[model samples]
Target chain A: MVSITSSRLVRGREARRAAPALERPGVAWAIPGLVFFILFAIVPMAGVVYLSLTRWDGLSTPQFTGLHNWWRFFSDGQILQSTLVTAVLLVGNILVQAPISILLGVWSAGYQRNRAVLSTIFFFPLLLSTAATAVMWRQLLDPNFGIPPKLADLLGGNTDLLGGQKGAIACLIVVTSWQFIPFHTLIYQGAARAIPLTLYQAAAIDGAGRVRQFFHITLPQLRNSIITSTTFMVVGGLTAFDIVLLLTNGGPGTDTSILPFAMYQTAFRTYDYGYASVIASFLLLLATGASLLLVKISGYDKMTSTMEGL
Target chain B: MRRRRNVVAGFAAFAWLLVIGVPLYALVNTAIQPESKYTDGGPVSIPSAVTLDNFRTVIHSGFLHYVWNTVLVAALTVAIVLLLGVPISYAVVRGRGWMTRGVFRLFLLGLAVPSQAVIIPLFLLINRLGLYDSLWGIALPTAAFALPVSVLVLSGGMRDISASLYEAMALDGARPARILVNLVIPLSRSSIATTCVFTALQAWNGFLFPLIMTQSNDTKLVPLGLYNFVSQYGGNVPALLAAVLMSAVPILIVYLFARRALVMGLMGAGGK
Candidate 1:
């Protein structure tokens, strides 16, 4: 025990001496970046909370209102409706995109020429900004001139795609899915490629057929990718406003208004900066909670910084 | 049985292909067709007459200016992300202090904080700094939002450098900067490339910030330009589609030219 202690101490001293070459960078190295991030990001996050307690329009001073906005948010039926729609959109997007991307991702991992060619086309949507894509889809969904009239059979003869609550929400989901599936598929593709041939060979030797092999092996191997992709979908779904603003603009009497859109309209359009900050605060809580859950579930906190410290 | 399964898979894949391809085809088909003939053929029809007038119209009516603005925003965002992200990532990777660790955690938490949530305070902050309508307004906040992913990607990369390489550089009396330049930078080229592509794309594709912050034509980004176009060219659907197609052209150019490197960089974001 004494010898072990002495050896450990000696090794520790050697490690300290050796590590200085790289570890010599002090906290000063991170300060510039940290300051920039804090000023722009962290400061604004804190400001949202402080501003939530005040009643301020753009021109006037932010007079302290003492939880007036929060009270309103809890009581307001519109906000309750917005929260439900937000949850609906979030679940809708994940359900629609997750399975399709996984199947596409696994298939596209093949070395087949057709798969490669098709996937290259699949990536085209990622190039367009959400704004651009949303703009294009808006035109496509036009009741008079767009594809809705042409494909009335496929869409249940609903010419007015944006006229009703369910139809408008469906359009949002369809457009969002089309735009984001390629990105998630790329994630799954990368993960699928990293999966070993040996595992498949072993599964085949066990007489596991193609479908069984996929369910037993490929699905299990894609665990991390599924989590990563779903995290993106959830986070993205929660703050989804650009597409909402461009496509629906919370039309049909706020039937499609999600939380972020509600925040945007309240702040910018109505000029209610205080109540907007309340919605903003709630968004912050949900987003931060999501990221916290992601970190905890994915062991992401253990993944990077913990690699440094003793 | 195997042949039947392949057929089923092929049919499903083809159906998906149509779902993706039809919209893209419509985008191009409408853009090329004369506006007068757009409704006659609907979206999926073959054009009676192809025209480039829409593209010309888009360029003349300040689309180029918006594109140029977007280019500048992307450049500034990439520069700030690299300049700040590299050293911060290095510190997070190598520094032993709790401060560095805390900063890393701060960024990690930043990963999911959507820029949409903070627009109220951000608008206020930008206004106070008198950068409200400027391109700097967009780039600064954009760079800040992008830094989380940039640092995450870069640090994940910087950690993979072998200790021996650093030790070797240090043995020659090299400091951290020189060692970074000689050892870490060279070794981290792929990740740096990934960072550049990812950061530039985020800045390029950024919408909410540019929308709330800048309203004038002088600072209009392509995405916002596209948004405003919806109302202005709302009647002229073909011209609007042309502009949307034009917005994607630059990225499409990169995809065509540096397909492999671009894809690898793209994959870098996902696997993380």
Candidate 2:
């Protein structure tokens, strides 16, 4: 009996060892991709870290600076301001947009009959490039010929929505929120739909109204989804580019200069690659830290289980 | 009570439609309005004159190259993503080992690290590879960045297949490689298609990578191309709007056709 069991185990191990290379006709195609990612992604990332310490001007040899760039980032008020701007956008995005999206998502999901149409319309903005959305909304907020001015005119005031800091920032907030809400709504709707109908029936039997049911049942069930959407929103808001680049370009006195744009301006426009890399490193650290926190807080294990089931 | 509930639901649906529809109406209306009446008229009023002049000018503004470039980039990126992501996903899903776990963690780290985080490094790397101003640079990075989501979706789909299928194949003397092609690929077709659509849209309309990576007109995608129009022809609202419309039409068509699949993929993977 011992000899037989040992032979079976050896056969099992042999089968396992042979499984991967045994007969995948399509496996050969993946080799090119493996090489591509290795060379382009993995290798270049190393070069970035290495070159960040050295000064290179796109042509000449790089000279090592040894944390001088990081020191400059601290002393340089502009880079600091850019970080602050990105943070402000993050805070504003979560504070202003998330709640409305949740409400709309819940409200829209409750009425499933029209969901296909309404959801499509809501997602329409997403189809447009950020450049196009920027242009459309920019035209709509044109201090002279735009929609906001027209509304302001009717309200008996002359306000330039894209001119001042408050107006410009507000317009950006509104446009970004408008552009992004459909994404969160889709997430929220999917989660809301996934909640077993029996939960709502039980809540109804308990005499809970729609609003109460939402708070007690829907919100709790959607906790994972809320965390997921929040993670995306925070990351996206922190690294916003296209909308700001087209509409404001951090204009009217450098008001909207977020970290990504600032990094770009520093490196390419000004040719200060070392300083730009310093800023880039900090941004990467912050984004990575936030993502880690998101995964921790959201119970990634549970989400993964749910995903696997689906 | 049933009748009352229907009325309420109807009213709510109408409200939803109003909020969504008006903005769309405004986008189309403003885009079609003639240039002469652009700023002088009421924002809510009907266009004084509708013309294809904007479309004509946009087509004439050398934006056709951008449209073609975007298509090429989005297509090639999707192809590369599938080529790489499918096997890795299959391996990770099927194999139970530290190596698989390690590979997965690498992708998860990638998920946490958005392309924006590595834009600076990516730029330097592209410059070094002599692909800085070329289309391949954007295609490669976009595919790399898209790998995490693609793997997530594809692996999720793959995991749903029963162990018995693999067992049966193994008993029949089929190798993992053969099973992947004959069984896995055929079964996961929808998932793969869905992944392709979402990744394509993401690549086509992506802003940041193309913004920093490519500087010249030869490799500019539609998004960058539209930005250039604003710089060259800001006051020409009709031309700019035309360019915007042209860039949006193709993606809009895809969205209309594959709306459910694309949204399902996003909600299943990244949207979640």
Candidate 3:
């Protein structure tokens, strides 16, 4: 009986060892997701690429136009202006949004007892849809009854933040930063909290003050999180559409129009499907290239390993 | 020095309150007061009379239909995301081979391709399939765009599960599917919840897709509905604010309940 049991056990181990190689169940498990992705994402992307080479109104058959759309995109001043606007927003986000969020994050981290309440308050805007945010700000910036105008009234100046060209762009940047700051703040805060308390204690014993400790320990430690957040901001700025669209409609005569907004208008209003695809493709390339460069610069592989460990 | 630090901290807290509190104050303050109060005292006036009239107006104008549509779309998108995201993440984590690696890479590529980039073709494809102006049309693409992050988070969650558990399960003659159901699903519950909330938020907040894909008023979601409300009721600031407040309430409630999962999930995605 003992011999028979041992033989059975050995056979079971052998079967189990062979099971993985023969099972191939991963393919079955992964197919539904693969199908959905291909149908919606991959295939549509391919269609964009194809349509970029052809001029097609929605009503008519697409005619092969070769590089006409690309050439047009190069010469088009509006498109170039939109690109410039997007670039400005990206730079503004990096310069203005990042520092403020980092400071808030650092401050929030220092005040551990009130962290939750502070985070909730700061992050509230993130939960509001872009549409709601845009409307809220539109109301707040109304030249007559809006808060900014009211404040401007108090300050004795006439400022229509969303009406003029430069003002509109600036307002868009401020509102976008306002909505997104909470997200980046949380990232920075998480990074801040992860730093060893021992490091701070050691610094204190060494006679380092708060400012010195922050600059020395906290800033260096939060480098990866900063890079990550900046990457998101850049990407987000490049693709900014909903808030811009709802708030200004890329308007006061195209002052606030970004690339995506221009692409959207070209496709839907002008009905230039092919040219829109070209713009879309261009934006895609820019986003992908910029993100990869940012990730490469920031040592994304190291970040991923650390994240996985978390 | 400690006293000064307290002063600075108190100032920071107050600054935050103004930065965040003022807008919420405006939204709610405008929402509760009557239209006459808004017009008479402007936005800054204290409300002498609180009224539900604005909400009544919004509801009477078929606001609930739009709300129902958004809820349905969000729910379906979440369901599809979890159904696909969970299993595929498991496969990517547990399966070994170039196919699994390649599949994971493919999903990651989805992250780079923003919906804005592919929306033109998505629009055409939806029309071609005769799904234009349908809620499913909007939900389908939203789920696809949401999948990359969902899979990333779930796979991260699954990887956190110990190898010993898998080995133990396998030693008991359990199949991969059985292991997934019994072990992986229960273990990755937090990640799953996170994905659900994240995807639902995306669906609820989706504007561009619904804007381009669906046209008729009957199919309008909240974002689009809010936009139309602004255009239609451009003069009725109180009524418009009421609609905005109502549209935002459900998601705000969700965030309140699932604040930890939401923040953790966002951080996980950001870290990645």
The numbered model that scores best in lDDT is 1
Residue-wise C-alpha lDDT for candidate 3, range A1-310, written one tens digit per residue: 9966886686578687885443324666888999999999999888888899999998889999999989988999998899898999889878878988898887777655576677668888877888888888888788887776567856468567777888888888878887888888888887888888899888888988878988999999998888888878877887889999889999899988899999999999999999999999998888877777664776532313333545
Clashing residue pairs, backbone N/CA/C < 3 A, model 1:
none
Better of 1 and 3 by DockQ: 1
How does residue B121 of candidate 1 score in lDDT? 91
lDDT for model 2 comes to: 0.75
Note each model's CA RMSD in angstroms.
5.8, 4.9, 3.6
Candidate 3 accuracy as lDDT: 0.84
lDDT of 2 by residue, A18-43 (tens): 65443333334344545666665566
For model 2 the local lDDT of residue A227 reads 88
Candidate 2 deviant stretches above 4 angstroms: A1-35, A153-158, A299-310, B1-19, B265-268
Q: What would the per-residue lDDT of candidate 1 be over residues A70-180, giving only the tens digit for each residue?
A: 999999999999999999999999999999999999998887788898888888888888998999999898988888999889888889999999999999999999999
**How many Å off is the CA of A33 in candidate 1?**
0.5
Q: Compared to the true structure, candidate 1 yields what TM-score?
A: 0.94
Candidate 3 or 2, higher DockQ? 3
**Candidate No. with top DockQ:** 1
Tell me the whole-model lDDT of each prediction, alpha carbons only: 0.88, 0.75, 0.84
